[model samples]
Target: MSTVIELAPGVRAGFTGRDGGVSREPYATLNLGGHVGDDPEAVAENRRRAARGFGLDPRDVVWMNQVHGADAVTVTGSGPAGDVDAVVTTVPGLALAVLVADCLPVLVADAEAGVVGAAHSGRPGMAAGVVASLVAEMERHGARPERCAALLGPVVCGRCYEVPEELQEEVARSVPEARCTTDAGTPGVDIRAGVTAQLKRLGVTNVTHDARCTRESTDLFSYRRDATTGRFAGYIWKA
Candidate 1:
């Protein structure tokens, strides 16, 4: 069975790990990212398995062409939801997925409203307010931010995600919660923390997280730790 993290009721949202897949090393096992040089067939099969984990067909899941920006799109059917970093949908059985390695994959849902969303929040995406944009898109679909719950998936932690001082400062300017010092006492950013803060700022108070740092966890795929590695996914759908 595929490992899944529990979220709120009436909705299914979870993250996939680097297991139960058919790819070889580097992209070993469950690599869901098609743009990461993994064999297309292997990636396809991995995605199929992921969908099955949620009791949905592979063709019913909508994946995004993430560009590390704040673009959010509403998914109306099963297919690619254009070049956006986040996708929200109210359609039952239509799962929305976001791919990530070191970056954060955020899943949000308002079970009562039957609206669900998934976002890819990297340094650039967070600084650009991707989470807030996602909540707004969810609201457009009748989801209330106050009633929404968010889940932050596995990602590189602040201690492991060292960045240049200037870049860190640039991101921190917009997301003050992102500012931090690395384990080595150099500059870094805890994007998950920032994302959580952003979610609350947008009135999404119920939030959960997978504290597993991708760079530190062998079960996860981290691009910063392994540049040639594959990517995992965060998925959300209404039951």
Candidate 2:
């Protein structure tokens, strides 16, 4: 079964794991990132497979160029949304995707308004407000946060996301809910907690989360666990 959540009527959102693709080892079999040194042809084919698996045409999905920033881009067509961490769309049937390894992938939708958005929230992006930008964009299209169904996909949990005290403090200063103590008693950042708090603060009431930690799950890709690794994707679409 897919890990994708059915956010609302006619709207579906999900995250992918490493299982089916053509990229060589490290990125072997199912790596979807085109800029991660994976074979371009292999990545293209993998993307097509992912799209088809979701009942969407390869050309019907909009991918993003995420730089761990807070930029949110709106889309009405199936093309790359450049240098953005989030992508929002009001067009039914158009899918928005965000690639992540250890970072959190957020998918949200208001099916009644035909608005859906996906965001890539890493420690920096979370502190910078990527999810907030997505919600604002969705709101512009008539989707209220109170009516949106949201899902936070697999992420590097705090227990495995140890960081320097300074770095952790920096992130926590911007998003207090993200700070945590690792299992080893080191400083950590809870990307999922920070994002969930952000969603709640935005008034999004129906938030759900996939409890899997990318760093801990062998099935999912994790850059923290494997520096050079494949990237899985999170997808959102309206039917």
Show model 1 residue runs off by greater than 4 Å: none
lDDT (C-alpha) at residue 191 in model 1: 95
lDDT of 2 by residue, 1-239 (tens): 16446778989877777987888998978999988888899999999988888788889999898899999988989888898999998887899988999999999988878889999999989999999999999999999889999988899999999999999999988899999999999999999999999999999979988999999999988898988988999998988
Question: In candidate 2, which residue pairs clash?
Answer: 4-14, 21-30
Local distance difference test, candidate 1: 0.89
What's the alpha carbon RMSD for model 1? Answer: 1.2
Give the lDDT of residue 92 in candidate 2: 79
Candidate 2 weakest lDDT stretch, 10 residues: 1-10
> Model 2 lDDT vs. the true structure?
0.89
Tally clashing residue pairs in candidate 2: 2
Per-residue alpha-carbon lDDT of model 1 for 1-239, expressed as tens digits?
Answer: 33555577888777888889999988999999999888999999999987897678899999899999998988789988999998888898898888999999999999888888999999999999999899999999799989988889888999998999999989989999999898999999999989999998899999998899999998989999989999988888887
The deviation in Å at residue 43 for candidate 1 is 1.0
